[model samples]
Target: AVANVCGFIASTLHRGIGLIHFPTTLLAQCDASISHKQAVNAPHGKNLVGSYYAPIRIIVDTDVLQTLEDWLLPDGMGEIVKHALCQDVDLLTYLEEYDGALNDPVFLDYIVRRTIELKCEVIDIDPKENKEAVVLIYGHTLGHPIESISHRMGTACCLSHGQAVAIGCVIAARVAFLMGLAEESIIERTEQICAKYDLPYLIPADQSVDRIMSKLPFNKTWTKEGTMMALIERPGKVFNFDGHFKCPVDDATIRRAVEQTMAPFGTIIKGSGSSGALRKNKLSNGDLASSTITTPIGSPMEKPGEGWAVSAGGSCPKGDC
Candidate 1:
């Protein structure tokens, strides 16, 4: 937070002023530190008011991470996993086989450096997020809403940004397979990685389908006709074969993805219908026939879980409502 505040201030005060980033948190070190997006939250929403400013140089030390709380360490890994899923097959393998904490010098140094390289691989191509860079946003489509709703819903536990995005990645992979654009391995591998890290891949019963869907920031993802998403055909590659990074998808698919994600172990392969049989694989320890998620196209879905659903600080009260 200080880096963003100071970085943004310095950028606006004088263009010639330069800053070097010494990010302390795992999230900052892995993702936000390298990111040129510097922003401050408005009274209404986060990152709503700010500028994109790059640091002059970023210096990271695995030693700094020792002071961080255990819960916070996974925050950066959420993004690291996203990068691997989108760009690097080897990084994905590295995460799968390794078992270590942020204090493990070997894992810490390699991942912190690897994440930076993977991110730059894309951001360098489209620095301003005009295109391509959005691959980094793979899980955030639903993750942002999940993160916001977790805190606002008065749940006993709030999901960290990393945890929420980890769930979102699982849902995205499922979304691709549901749409018949990607193979089932995408979903399986993503879910496996999250489990390997002990990250929360299942939505808590408190986080309802309605609240999450309502809060999704689809201003960039939605089009006039329907919604679009940055889905991957497989690990280390995006499913944007149409020459556009933003792939078109039906509205029902996005909703179903949210619904399935909300339900515990909810991944039903192939709509049991007349079009054709899909390559189906039920999630481990998941019952294909029992989940309330069993619904046909356009049917009334699961209601929001019973709880107090507060608007996120009245973000949609008047102007944007």
Candidate 2:
């Protein structure tokens, strides 16, 4: 499906025809739109063939969502979850208050407005993802690995992109908490939002932990080191602490965290077992410990002049950089 869609777009570009994407599926709307456009496909995974080209325009008509299925609504909700966590806390509150009634004209309008505004804000600052725009990938780094490996295992429908990302955000937050960049409350808050929307909160224990971790090194934004974890400073901001944490944390810690977050709901993989499913592997029962992450060399500490200084002191609402 994706290849055909991309082939059509590529053909049009070759013929000098401008491309405009009007994604209707919740999966297409959030995940496919960006993944198809930005991330290129690698030999090991999907979406390896692509370029960064801005669409002439994106029209996310809420009315179109009226015919969506129950599952599709949550798929789109995952994007809302991402936007809320990284960019707008108000949107999180709104979703928490209203139980995903995207069919409502007023609610759909609100989501479309906020989603567009958030994307535009990201573009205005760094459309090309050159500088701090890395914040837009808050949940994607770890999430993609999960999706890729799942597909590799022949369980393509196992998890959606947003579901993988919804799980990844909590994992990233847990890493951030370990680094002291965020508090436990923040992690809990993230969980609360995910739970409200029924997003996947953990990975299946039977998943190939090794294969999933392998995908980390392929990140274009990653440094030479395999370590890549985004540090959450505040809303509308994320520090891509590439090479900050250890490459693969101990199996014990990974299992504990993955299982703990997932216990509330059923096992990470719900429904019937697939034909090519692997045997169940268990996470070791032991203490999971992570120390504080330090600043990389040449990347100076947060002194007066470090990072992008938008303005000095009380200039911006969130306080000056």
Candidate 3:
């Protein structure tokens, strides 16, 4: 998000500043840099302080991606999968059928361009994200809170942005299926793609669902009526209410979906337990295979990373290198 901030700084200071972006990471190349929006995370919430300032130009350099840690390659694919869910099933099909190595630079460049094309299509319809573009945030409603709250907690390592969003996409799909907004196939396909990419499909044990609930109100999707969520009907189709892509959701309903998502795989959790504790933490494939690594990407904090080598999860890489 250093590039995101620089774009923001350029907007805040000058007449466009003729700012140009040379996005290096898969995350930026595929999703972050394509947007006309330039924002940074805040102590209060994600992307809370920012503006919509289009860059003069954005150049994707897949060659720069040669140095990205292998663990980081999948980081951008979360958004790509999300784009497929929002409006491109063929893209999803390609990813599902592909068996090649993800480390292939050729593959990386292809997917990056593909993701940018999808994002641009959405941006063309709603450049400001006030309408259709919000669909691009398919996983972020719950994902943001999960990532944000995880950062504040100390018991477990924080979930990377990709991991958090991957889980968030599953939750949104599952919630849609629960609400009858989507069919069971939607949920299954969502989970299947996430698992295929090796993205985390389960919430970490360290996170509190209630805490996640508390943070929902701060979401930008909120209106005086309540929060709205981005749910999909099928691959390439988002659930639309009236003329819009999101629908207003109540606390009781959203909480139910969140709890159900946190529940063990196929077991639908009833209400919270009688004694005020949650149901038995029945760990499944997700929990069983999960790895809680120290932040793989120490990026985009409200406070900029100081010179090189601040620390493991908080240090700036430029300083270390």
* Residue-pair clash count for candidate 2: 6
Please name the candidate that would achieve the greatest TM-score relative to the true structure: 3
Q: Tell me the TM-score of model 3.
A: 0.80
Query: What residue pairs clash in candidate 3, if any at all?
Result: 308-319
Model 3 spans > 4 angstroms off: 263-321
lDDT of 1 by residue, 1-321 (tens): 567777777678766378789999777888877878777754323455567788889888888888887766776788889988988889999899886664787888888899888788888888876568878878877776666555442333356668778878988898899989888878878988987775767666555666566654433576766556678888888877467777766667877877776643233221111111111233233533332222222222244332222233322221111
Clashes of each: 0, 6, 1
* Candidate rank order under TM-score: 3, 1, 2
User: Whole-model Cα lDDT per candidate?
Assistant: 0.68, 0.55, 0.71
Q: Where is model 2 more than 4 Å wrong at Cα?
A: 1-8, 11-16, 30-43, 99-102, 154-157, 240-268, 271-321
- Better TM-score candidate (2, 3): 3
- lDDT ranking from best candidate downward: 3, 1, 2
Winning model by lDDT = 3
Provide TM-scores for the models: 0.78, 0.70, 0.80
lDDT of 3 by residue, 48-166 (tens): 88888888788888988889876677777777888888788888888899899987878887888888888898798889887888788889999898777655423233466776788
Displacement of the residue 152 alpha carbon in candidate 1, Å: 1.2
1 or 2, which is superior by lDDT?
A: 1
Instruction: Report the alpha-carbon TM-score of model 1 versus the true structure.
Output: 0.78
